[model samples]
Target chain A: MALLEVTNLSITFGGLRAVDNFNLTMEKGELYGLIGPNGAGKTTVFNLLTGVYKADEGLIKLDGLDITGHRTAEIDRDGIARTFQNIRLFKDLPVIDNVKVGLHNQFNYSTAESMLHCGRYHKVEKEMDEEAMKLLGVFDLDKERDYLSANLPYGKQRKLEIARAMATKPKLLLLDEPAAGMNPNETAELMETIQLIRDKFDMTILLIEHDMKLVSGICEKLTVLNFGRILAHGDTKDVLANPEVIKAYIGE
Target chain B: MRKTQKKTLITYAIVIIAYIILEIFMKAGMMSSHLKGLLVPMVYYAIAAVALNLCVGILGELSLGHAGFMCVGAFSSAIVSQLLSGAIPDALRFILALIIGVVISALFGMLIGIPVLRLNGDYLAIVTLAFGEIIKNILNSIYLGVDSAGVHLSLKSQMALGLADDGKVLINGAMGITGTPQDSNFTIAIVVLLISLFIVQNMIDSRDGRAIMSIRDNRIASESVGINITKYKMTGFVVSAAIAGAAGVLFSHNIATMQATSQYFGYNVSIMILVYVVLGGIGNIRGSVIAACILYLLPELLRGLNKYRMLIYSIVLIVMMIINWSPALRDKRDKLRKKLMKGAGHGAA
Candidate 1:
């Protein structure tokens, strides 16, 4: 069974069909890439999947569970975690806490316990710190764990966000233009991290990107979106070579 | 973790040292009775400021109805203490009142938070502002008494209550509750303040605190990461309200008479508490404490200035703002501190 299945997903903003008849299926541990030109509604599709936007008509199933129209947190608990196109780390909180917030549901302590610092609070907090530190280690953010997330340099901020998302322990991870503003060197490093993450965590990944290098290097399957419609869908090499997909990217 | 622990310890130390010094001054007869009278109010105001900071700074919600929570605490606890005066021992009665106050206000917090939190920014602020005034007005018009006939409540005149001969009026409309037991003292107020500090600081360092703050930072990201936004927001808001209620308990118990009035539990008081939160450096709990103490005492201390009192206060407020927030002023202060440290090092050498 597919980890995530979206059938006939569509949304409209007034008369404009922002995302129309979008269908996607990802098998367990598949690395999928979604690429498109500007205004291609790629992020809109991610929003629909994450429950940031309610789909006008669609069926979203996660791990055989019908999760259509569930709220973002509900969908996340049902096993889908995502990073934003514009990096959204808890800016005022420390780097470790950003991940610890992601680790929130996995741990347990009541409001009273947290307030009074009694009961299971100490043990749970220590465990959270350890788990967060280990995740930070994976992203090489351990050295900067105590720094406020807003203070980190751009590349590291992106990595911290991904680490925070990964901390949620989701089965399906969505990366919306994870390498959006990176130069070649950082983009290459990010590509390696993405592959490493898939292998290490056995994650089913879907990412939107304009960076062809990172996309071609890491994505096994590709789906091209243009003006809210799928232009091509196949293995990465075949989809990229398709004349229609190429035309949407460069020009006719 | 160690850094935060040390910082919290410093905050505790500051409160403790201030308490000790004030005690010494009082024992030495250096404090006027007027100054002594101001002590409990100052502490409670500081406590209220800390509570407001929890909501405004940490939860990232602007609540203009904090004084309403305080008002709820004050009245409910006062009534409980009054009714239970002889049934429970005095200390125990006060403790029960405090607990009841916190719990009742927390309930009010959750009730108000449910609908109010759905709105954001200015809308939330406006609604809370209305709620605060509404609470005060409702309390003002209530007349409550108890007798062998169970309990009597009236929105009309006290005569309408038609209580039994031995009936005791707990709350009189407009006049408010008179003869509330003066169970609160400076020491008790300070102790409550310390507990508030402990709860807020500990919660901020814990996992749930991180979740609440994450919502404050970004709602969408927090939700995507499986942090329940509504639950955490309510948690922060309600806890903050409960603490404000504790301060209210202190307030009612310290006063000879507790009244629901614009002077005490109005929008102005809420805004004043907010000023403490902002001037103390919002999200800085210790800063709230210090700001509340100094700002609350300033006008009282300058009463001798008479006509110039408020004028001086306006200047102080402006100075505090610049000192705390102005980038240029902060840079200069930082440089000065660094130089002072360098000079101290040279002297040691």
Candidate 2:
């Protein structure tokens, strides 16, 4: 059975159908890519899936359990995590704290225990610190763990956000425009990091990218969306070769 | 130690050392009686300011109904203490009063937080402001009395309770609660302040604190990370309210008669607490305590200045704001701190 299945997911705002009858099915550990021109509603689909926006009509299921319209935090607890296009880190906090926030649910200490620094609080906090440090190490951010996230350079900030998401231990990870603002070298590094995270963590990934090179290098399957609907989807090369995909990208 | 943990330790040490020094000076007759009288109030207000900071600074929510929660604590605990007077030891009675005040105020916090926390920014502030006014007005007109039969309550006055001649009027409408045991002292106030600091500081360093701060930093990001926003928001708000309530109990016991007037539990008082938090530096627990103590005592200390007292106070406030928030000064302070830390080999090595 697929790890995630979305059927007839549709939403409209005012008169515009932001997403229309979007359907997706993903087996465990698949690396998928979502591509679209600007305003093609790719992010809207992600928003709907993550429960930032409710779909007007549809069903979203993970591990065969219906999860449509669940709260964003609930969806995350159910093993789904995502990175934002704008890179939202707790700017004033240290990089490790940002990752520790992603590990929020894994700690079993009660508020009273934490406030008194007793029992589970000490044990769980030590464990979380170790875990957060490990995740930061994976992204080459362990050295910068004590620095405030806002002080980091752009590429590291982006990588830190993904590392933070990984701390949630999600079964499926979503990346919205992960390569939107990167130099060629940084993009190449991100591509390797993304591949490494997927393999080492053994988690499925669905990414939205404008960088075709990054998409082609890492994505196993591709889905092209245009005006809130899927235009073509299949093997990466075939979808990229479709005449419809070309016109959508070039604005015919 | 981590940088933040070390900072927290230094803050606590500074507060405790300063308090001890002041106490020593007072014992040596180096301080005036007016200054001595201000000590207990200074500690209580400092505690309240810390509580307010948890909401305004840490949780990143502007709450103006803090005075309302304080009032709830002040009245309920005052009544309990009055009822238990002569039957229990003063120390035990005072402790129970503080606990009762905390419980009552925390309940009010949760009750108010449920609907108000749903609104964000200005709307939340407005609702809390309205709640503060509502609580103040309700306390003004209400009359409460205890008799052999049981408790009696009325809105008009003592006569409305229609009690027996032996009955005691606990709350006399607009006159507020009277004859409550004055068990508050400098030592008790200081102990309360320390407890408040312990709770607020430990909370800020804890996992729950991280969740609260993350929500404040970015709601969408925090939610996406699987944090229950309502639960964490309530945690901060209720804990803050409980602390404020404890402070209120201390306050009521220090004064001869406790009144729930606008001057006491009004919008301005809420704003004053916010001012303390803001002037001290938001999310800085140590700053809140210092700001509260200095600001609360400044007027009394400057009483000899007569007409210029408020003027000097206002100028101090403005200067504090500039010092705390001015970008240039902040940058300089950060640089100085980094330099000192590096000089001490505190940086990553």
Candidate 3:
């Protein structure tokens, strides 16, 4: 069974069809890329799959469980996690707390236990802190763990967002424009981080990017979206050479 | 101790010591009668402000109906104490009243929160403001009575209750509940305030508190990380309402008669509580308590200033706003904090 399956996903906002008849199937551990021009419904597809928006019509199955129209948090708990196009770290929170939030579901202690600092609360918190520290270390954020996330440099903020999302232990991770505002050097580093995360965690990744160089270097398979529909999709090199994909990127 | 733990310990010690010193002065007749009378009320308001801070500051949801929850607690506990008077010792009766108030208020919080929390920002503020007004109006016309036959409630007036001579009237329309046992004092208020502080502070440091704060900081990110938005929001709201209810119990029992007036439990009161939270520093539990105490006592302290009392109070508020929110001040404060942490690190080494 595919790690993720979406069939005929359609959504319209007002008069605009933000996404229409979108379909995707990903094998476990596959690294896929989704690319489209401005306002071509790339992020909309991510939103639909993550349950931030209910598709007007379609089916989404993850691990063979039909998960279309579930709550956003429920979709996440079902093993899908996503980062935003714009960095959305918990800005005022310490970097460690930002990652610990992703571990919220793993704690088994009751609210009462936590309030009184009894039993599982202490044990679970210690474990969570250790795990969070390890995650930060993987992202090269160990030294800045005590600083507020907003105080981090722009590149580090983007990295921290990914680190936080990964802390949820997702089976399928989605990145939306993770390299949007980075310099060329930062983008190269982020590309490396993305590949490393996939290899280290053994997780499937679906990325949306406008940076052709980063996508070309890392994405094995590519899906091109235009006007809320798939223009072409297949192996990255062949799909990028398609005439329709060329026109969609350049002009009419 | 960890830095945060040490700060928390010092805050508690300072509060306790101040309370002790104030009590000593009051007992020695060194404090004025008016100042002494303000103590219990100040503590009650401080507790309420702390409760509201959990909702407004930490949860990042503006709730203007806190006064309505406070009213639910106040009236419910007052009625219970009246009904159970003479049957139970005052101490046990007061404790039971407080528990009952907390439970009922929490239920109301859940009831109102489920639908109301669906809205955010200004819409939420408007809805809660309306809820507070509705609660105040309802309390004005409510008539409650207890007798050997059981309890009776009427919305029209006390005449509608039609209680027998042996029966007792608990709430008499706008006249409100009367003859409540004045069991609350400054010491009890202080203890309750401390408990409020403890619960709020502990909750902020807990796993659940992290989830709550995350929701406030970034709702979409929080959801993406699998934090159930509704469940956590309700948890914070209900706990906030319960604490407000406890404060209400303290308030209702501190006086012989309690009226359901806008001045006490209405839109204005809710806004006033929000002001305390904002002026204190959002999400700072200790700041909320100190702000509540100082702001509550300020008016009484300036009462001798006559007509200039309100004018001076407004100037103080404006000055506090500048100090608390100015960007320049914030930068300086942050720099100072960094220096302090560095100094502490050197000392430890």
Candidate 4:
């Protein structure tokens, strides 16, 4: 069985079909790419899958469980985590606290424990902080833990988002436009970070990126979307070689 | 683990020593009466201000009827304490009275928060303002004053629900409760203030507090996160309402002639409490406490201005807003603040 499945999923906003009849399937441990020209509904699929927008039509199942309408926090707890297309870090929070916010899902202390600073609270907080620091270390962001997320350089902010999402301990990680405003050097560094994190964390990743070079380099499987529909899907080379995707990009 | 635990233990030891010293000074006459008096309004208003902070700052919802909740707390405690002047132990009686006050106010909060928490902006302001008036009218309709029998007969009775002695307040209508016992003191007030501070601080730092901010920052984002915005908003509302209620009890019980005449728990009181939060730079707990002190003192400072005091205050508030919101000035202030904290943190380290 597929690890994640979307069947005929459609979402509309009062006459504007933001996403229509979207469908895909993913295997466990796959690193996949989703690509489209601007306004091609790539990000909308992410929104729908993450439960930001309700699907007006069709089904989304993650590991045999229907997640079409799970709450975003619930979705995160259920082994699925995603970064936003536009960076949505809790901009004012310290980088460590931003990651801690993700770890809020994993906390097991009571209010009483916190108030009295009980043994359980301290123990849980210590364990969680160490785990969060380990995640940050993977992204080479442990040094910047005290910095406010908004103050980070553009590339570091993207890394912070990934570091944050990883704190959720997701089984399937989704990164949206992770290399948006990077120079080649930063993008090249990001490529290694993403691959390293995938290997270290042992999680499947689905990414939507505009940079074709990054897409072609990292993705083993790919899906191409256009105007609310899937234009192509399958192995990265086949999806890229598909006539419809070629036509869509050529016409653009 | 070894180094950090040792450092934290030393830090905690210092904090405990400081706390003990402060408590000793407070209990002794080491602090001046003027400072003590100043702290009275500070603690009282802080209780109400934190509630306002929850509704106005954290939940990012507006309510102009906060004073009405305070009114509920004050009267509830006043009546209970007055009626029970001889029935219970000195300490336990007062505790019961305060509890009654908090519970009553929480009920009022739940009643108001259910409908009003959903309304945002000016619409919420109007609803809350009207709710305050309705409470005032209801209070006014049931008078409590000296009667022909020389017994205090208020429109409402001090009698516990069904306990008898319909001695009359709603058992007399708008004369208002007279001859009520005034038993609240600095000790009681400060203890309540500390509890209020503890609750407000805990809520602010907890996941629930973050959830409240999440609700304010982005409604859709918060809901998508399974935050149950309504529950968290109501939590802030009720907790704040209960604190305000406790303040009301303390106020009514503190002063013998605590009057709610004309505009007692009126719009101005609500605005005054809200100003405490806004002036402190919304969302800053320490800032709220400071704001309460300065704003409470502003009126006394205006005593020399006599009639012009309010005018000066109004101007000061407006000028403060101009200074605060100007991007360039705010950025400069942030830089200065960060520099100071860095210096302080380093020194502490």
Per-model CA lDDT versus the true structure: 0.93, 0.91, 0.90, 0.75
lDDT tens readout by residue for model 1, A1-252: 888898999999999999989989999999999999999999999999999999999899999999988999998899899999999989999899899999989999998898889999989889999999999999999999889999999999999999988998999999999988888889988988898898889889999998888888889999999999988898999999999988988998
Docking class of 2: high
Candidate 2: tens digits of C-alpha lDDT, residues B1-349: 8777787788778878987898899889999887788888888889989999999888999888888888999999999999999899988999999999999999989988898776656566888789889988998999999889888999876788989877999889899887888899887888888888888988988899999999899989999999999999999999999999998998899889889998889999999888899999999999999999899989888999999999999999999999899999999999998899888885555
iRMSD per model? 0.7, 0.7, 0.8, 3.2
Each prediction's number of clashing residue pairs: 0, 0, 0, 22
Cα lDDT over the full model 2:
0.91
Task: Give every collision pair in model 2.
Answer: none
TM-scores of chain A across candidates:
0.99, 0.98, 0.98, 0.95
User: True interface contacts reproduced by each model, as a fraction?
Assistant: 0.91, 0.74, 0.78, 0.13
- The DockQ scores of all candidates, in the order shown, are 0.88, 0.83, 0.82, 0.25
Tens digits of per-residue lDDT for model 4, B85-177: 788786888789889999999998898878867655456678778877788677765544322354443344444223334433422234455
Query: Which regions of candidate 3 deviate over 4 angstroms?
Result: B156-160, B334-349
Model 2 chain B weakest 10-residue run by lDDT: B116-125
Q: Write the per-residue lDDT of candidate 1 for residues B1-349, one digit (tens) a residue.
A: 4889888999999999999999999999999999999999999999999999999999998989899999999999999999999998999999999999999999999988898776656566777789889999999999999999999999998999999999999999899999999999999999999999999999998878888999899988998998888889889999999999999999999888778999999999999999999999989999999999999999999999899999999999999998999999889988998899899999999
lDDT of candidate model 4 versus the reference: 0.75
Best by DockQ: 1
Model 4 TM-score is 0.84
Pairwise TM-score winner, candidates 3 and 4? 3
Candidate 4: share of reference interface contacts reproduced: 0.13
Looking at model 4 chain A, which ten-residue stretch has the lowest summed lDDT?
A110-119
lDDT of 2 by residue, A1-252 (tens): 999999999999999998999999999999999999999899999999999999999999999999998999999999889999999999888899999999998877899986777778778888999999989889999999989999999999999999988999999999999988899999999999998998799989999999999999989999999999999999899999899999988857
Question: What ranges in model 1 sit over 4 Å off?
Answer: B331-349
Error of 4 at B245 (Å): 2.1
For candidate 4, the clash count comes to 22
